[model samples]
Target: MKNDNVILGIDLGTSAVKCVAMSTSGGIVATTEAAFPLTRDLPGQAEQNPADWLTALELAVTRLGRDVTMNAVAIGLTGQLPTLVCLEGAKPLPSAITWMDSRADAWASSFLDDSKRQMMYDRTGMPIDGRYLAPMFRYHRETFDNGVGTILSAKDFLHFALTGELATDPSTAAGYGLYDLDGANWSQELCAVWGISSSLLPTVRPSASASGLREAVAARLGLPSGLPVTVGCADSVASAYAMAGLDSGTVCITSGSSTIIMDSLPKPLRDSQRRYLLTPHIADGVFGREMDLLSTGTSYRWLNDLLGWENGRIDIAAARSQAGANGLLFSPYLAGGEQGALWNPNLRGVLHGLTVQHSSDDIARAYLEGVQFEIRRCVDILAEDSKIERVVLAGHAASHSATMQMLADILGRPVAAYHHRSPAAIGAALLAAPSAAHSKQMPTDKAVAVPSQLRADYEKIYRRYCAMFPAIAEAAD
Candidate 1:
């Protein structure tokens, strides 16, 4: 590993494109980001033009400085999963349907009955829903007068833009709700059920498999021509790999707009309750039992806007408020549904026990605590199968030490959070590196210990939260 050698990692996130240039020796050379807009004009709609991702990627790469871009040894790709992008030849449709969109919910709800859903879950390890690519495509076909040419996820589109390859890694392909975990290939029956053709789907490849970059695309980004680009796994998988490798004992929670709680397993492990998603992991032969919180940082950001406070002020106010938010319990399901811990798609947000004594600070604190309580529930579920030796936090929510401490107190264990930039991108960079050099990419992390004083109070609140969730959720529904 030389200091000059670098790997370029790009993450086409929900909100923006985050790019990181890291040396094979584990040092971050440079980082840059380019923001893009998410359109939500209609009900249950969330979309972005596919062109925006490529534009953002080029802009982000240009900001990485010419020297760092030129010295890159390889490029790695990772991003949000299940974002459906339709490509007609080399051009994409007007907009790409993001994972956050739920316009297909009605179709999804009515399409599969209990027996069919159970069969799909047993075979695919994914609790199929409207947010998945197959459902979105079905909805698109029925409503719009467009012909289906090819289907690709967000990162796969980026990979095609850069390397002229129409392929997806297993981790991302699993999000389509058609990949068979046992067969390790696309399920033709499931595809027919969704009315999606197998030929329209992208080819599945290993996450770290490489393709040569297109000369024209490389020239536009000011990088070396014909550089190898590795189509990495989902952002959640990359985040998990960045902090804790493919080991089984560690749980990695990426708390961003949405929170992903996952633990890798040597083989496929399905939940009897079907509460968690079983997906392919960073590489072959490994799988992840995963749970996702639909809204975490999104709730925090919503509160910031509602309260007219700055971005980081919510953490300060949350820290000041006493434990339990003075009995004001908040259900952080502002996303109209939840994924893990409770797989109820009709569930809505609830702010229970609000009275005159509750102030904005209390509301903020309650919501912050609410998110961690949800994480605690998912953690407990993961702990059923794995020992959970350590918990690692990544993404934007890990920046606030006070909130991290609150999480630690709620979970009753120390959590190591990477306070640096995007761990997913760094993880992708490590994947892009030579296989033998992957060990060098584990960066330093900050450990937050549980505070004894708050632990007791959170314990009581957590119990009450667990007891009150069903009633509140039912009422809210």
Candidate 2:
């Protein structure tokens, strides 16, 4: 029989809300998910109604309650980071601006002076990009006429919705471009430069600290009032925590709508070239993490869309039919470019080395290879300072596909696939687990590993793909 003291972890994602209930022994009791749409008003504008997240959270929690015993001890929340959510008191001033939105490119570009950019990067471990918080905040202050009282990231906003408390964890704040990793607080220098006040930001809190929940929210979800809510980290950090391998040499690679490669570091390290970003870990002030963000599974989605294969299901078997993709090479930069190598948004997608012999299968294989090549680039960058011994892969795309074996082989490292369905929720649950004083000690769970057979062939293709990037970059130029 399960214990009455349960912990619930909620992941309020850009596309969906997922909730997981866990027993005190670290066993998953009940899980539920509810999805919402991303509203694209214009070519570059990606927004979501904040009300949608609240509605999804209510439904997901309500569903969880119907299937399980109502004994949630604590709740932890995690989701997409750096998305700007403008709020006036409790209400939203504008729809949540998603992380993918790049309307602030012009605003961000003007601050590209080498010295100023380097200074900001040195303090924040983040580059001056439109996807970051500073640029988004600037956009809101300068463009929006509506009164704005506070700014919260997607997960932070959801936390506020649930707890009626405005706060953010260090992991989420690190990506905002306002956080000073060296100082461990919001940067007054950057705030002054951007002409924004620091008071508008939420209070910074630890990842697992008890963020109080509101009675009204608990009543709506059929949960107990005053349930202890842990201020959770970003999805990547939370996913890393769920993997439970936070040693110095281990890396966590999440291949989903995007590929995020992050590894733990005892202290901050900067490169002369300013390639990678270092962010605070969930256990802030003690550990830091390095990240390389790129489009991974998104490339596959793009190819599938191009082939009109939108049957809403991925046909992996068909993709295996064309070995080596019949010499096709694709550059997977559909949603613009990411870290290390920034490309112009106007740069068109390419299908190089196409021939009359090529088929849809070839395109699919090439698409997969292109994303792997990007991952290899990130791995190479991180290897500059950190000795990455192994990589733990998480996310629906990485867990479901045999193609991930190709990625493991290409990187020449063991790739362990952690729990597939929803790691963010599991990570959140781990974060919300009652303190040792409140429950018995439970053994930590390890991530599930992918088979070794898939790694061999994938390594061969990865080597050839890596050799092809210079020429591809030249072509794009």
Candidate 3:
């Protein structure tokens, strides 16, 4: 007989809430999604109301309740990391400071000294970025009164709202820039320097362990009271899980609002160059993953908006016509910037080699290539040890184009796309299911793209692009 109890996975994304219920056998019994608007009051400000997330969560669970069994075994929650939310006695005081927001750049620069910052990177495996919690915390302290009760990320706040639990998993805490990657805990010294209180932060927990559900929340969702809720992970980590735990020498790529490249390591790997971030795996002490975040899909969206593409309707024929793009090149740093080079908030988008001969198709193709080039840079940095064996691509953008195949050829590696449409939600479901302790079934993978025969053609173009990086950097300077 099938397991009577089901596992529920809730993903609180930047623009949507995705929920899934799964049988112990890894079958998806029910799935639901609800979307909310991401508001931008100013050019650099991206904000979302916390109430919208709560509403979406309620709606998604209610939608799921319409079809499937209600005896949920456990609930696992995931969300975009580093977005900050301030709360006063469980009430949100302001809109969430989204991960894309760059308002804290000056604040981050003011508080984090160079030596201390390097120590932080050594301890946390994360380079200093304005989006991290410590920077935003400093911004809040300088701008707001100290009386505000606590500040939490979007996921941590949602976890508390659902189960009255004040806790975070290592996966989410890793993005805070204060959590010690080596120590596997929040660094009191770092927090003190930023004038943050340790008491305001949630307790760190294992990503898959039980977080007892609260009665009030249970009644609202029609779930059984006292049910177990798994401590959730960062959405990227959850996606990694859904694809399959990073085996020895494997990497995962997710192209969303930003591009995230992650690879599993047997132990914490600190880069003296600080090219990428290392964080504890969601699966406890079993592993760690390194991350590189850059603006990839955001560049695509920028082009679409510029060309008046409505409803995500892209002219596929036009896009393909300009594959080589007549030697056009673009630097996709539209929304601030990230990664090892030029971590500048002031960096703007640039389109090089533009001329009257170049068409919209050329611009579009160049945009795609630009993003792929950035991905290749990160991959090269992470592959220094020659440990990466395979590459798995996930996320909506990865599914949308032949662009990924070009990326594979450029990297000289085969790329496989997993079947799971929303890997993060699927991974959340896997995390929620305690049956993994007793059963042997695991998530499966399906390939959507592979290495193209035109590897040599793409390589030539890739080298030309690589050769242009120094010039591009100089131009940006």
* Candidate of highest lDDT: 1
Using TM-score as the yardstick, the better of models 2 and 3 is 3
Rank order by TM-score, top first?
Answer: 1, 3, 2
Q: What does candidate 2 score in Cα RMSD to the true structure? A: 3.1
- Superior candidate under TM-score, 1 versus 3: 1
Cα displacement (angstroms), candidate 1, residue 188, comes to: 0.7
TM-score for each of the candidates: 0.97, 0.90, 0.92
The parts of candidate 1 lying over 4 Å away from their true place are 1-3, 444-446, 475-477
Q: Output the lDDT of residue 317, model 2.
A: 42
lDDT of 3 by residue, 1-477 (tens): 234567888889877898888777677777898988787888668888899998888888988874353678788889988898888777876678888888887667666677877988888878786888878777756566666687788889988887787788998998777787767898998888777888888888888777677888888887888888877889888877777565657788876667677877767777777767777776555454555555566656666787888624433523464445688877677777555344555556678788998877777778777777777777888788657788888765455546656667767897776655667887888877776632322344454456677677777777887787656566653
lDDT of 3: 0.74
How much RMSD separates candidate 1 from the native structure?
Answer: 1.6
Q: Which candidate, 2 or 3, has the higher lDDT?
A: 3
Using TM-score as the measure, the top candidate is 1
Residue-level lDDT tens digits of model 2 in 395-433: 654444566566665677767666546677778878778
